[model samples]
Target: MYNKGTIIPGLVIFIVFVTFPLWYNGLNAGTVPKPDLPIGQKECVAPAAEMRDNHMKLLNEWRDAVLREDDRVMVKVGGKEYRKGLQMACMQCHNDKEKFCDSCHTYAAVQPTCWDCHLTPKEAASKKETH
Candidate 1:
């Protein structure tokens, strides 16, 4: 049997180690959204154009890195590299994909097909551990 004093320490540990992450993730989950370009910019014009260009550049770099099969760039867990496909999820870099991916997609009138095919990092990590 545990002492009453020990129970308080154990509860503190649980709150710090377990409940904190749950609360943190819950708060962050809603914070990710896509980029929002200026309104009425058909060709990604003006200041918004620069943002679009930068975004495309980043995406292209990511694509190129993946095509080169650069395992070194892959996401690491316990110092192990995950495969490219498994690592390509939006949250890998853009932790706020709801804010980053969705916001830009809405502005561009383009529906990202990511949700149609890909699982989120949280989901993927969970599945990975079970397997």
Candidate 2:
């Protein structure tokens, strides 16, 4: 009877500690679809274009803010202040490369070799060896 209770507790422990994080990470790595716009709605109907334009404008503003040296919004890493770019911000909504990066890269016919040399901004390589 004690062994049976122990089995259930051990299984629960394994599920909570081991399986849960792996499942969470896997779920986080994939592309999350936008709730408002369902899949297969590629062609601009009318209002979508305006909304897209507005979104682009906001993105550009964010980019400009980061580019500005005077702007205090920055992340400090290894004693250097690095401005956050669009890629970092945008990835919050569109996490997968196929959903976000590939779409724009394909549209512009530009192949970005970023993944070859660079990890995501959050996981940037250590600068300790540079100096």
Candidate 3:
């Protein structure tokens, strides 16, 4: 049989590295996915489930429509229509991107470059307020 001392240390190291992600996430996990609604807000333009699951997709579509195609049209879902602009529509309710966007993004360990182009209302307001 192989040496138990070497086998145990190697096994322990393997498990630690393998489970590092889980432990790290657990340590950092907190009330991220809680109600990220603005004060006194009722509902989003799209449903919460759709927004949570497919926000990036919708953003990509919006980017393409706005930038590449120049096709700024109304987005209709569930018998409701919204003008397709991140800065115009989304930031209306989700103005606090640090709380809403950063919370979920941090939990999921994804670094979305949404703010690279589209500025949050708070940030824009700060700019306007300062200048």
Error of 1 at 94 (Å): 2.3
Going through the candidates in order, what is the number of backbone clashes in each?
11, 0, 0
lDDT of 3: 0.78
In model 1, the Cα lDDT at residue 112 comes to 53
RMSD values for the candidates in order, in angstroms, are 18.4, 17.6, 3.4
Q: Model 3, residue 64: what's the lDDT?
A: 93
Evaluate all candidate structures by whole-model CA lDDT and list the values in order.
0.55, 0.53, 0.78
TM-score, cand. 2 vs. native: 0.32
Candidate 2 lDDT over 1-131, as tens digits, reads: 56988899988888788778676787565544443333433432225567455755654566567666545366443344444554554443344556555665565576655566545534443453454
Those runs of model 1 whose alpha carbons end farther than 4 Å from true positions after fitting are 1-51, 69-93, 113-118
> Whose TM-score is higher: candidate 1's or candidate 2's?
1
Worst 10 residues of 2 by lDDT: 37-46
Cα lDDT tens digits for candidate 1, 57-98: 654565667767564355443344444442453344444455
Tens-place lDDT digits, model 3, residues 15-113: 999999887878765564664677765677668789779989988888898889998888663455667788767776677888888876877799988
Please report the candidate that would top TM-score against the real structure.
Answer: 3
Pairs that collide in candidate 2 are: none
Residue-level error in angstroms, candidate 1, position 64: 2.3
TM-scores, all models, native as reference: 0.35, 0.32, 0.74
Off by over 4 Å in 3: 21-29, 39-43, 74-82
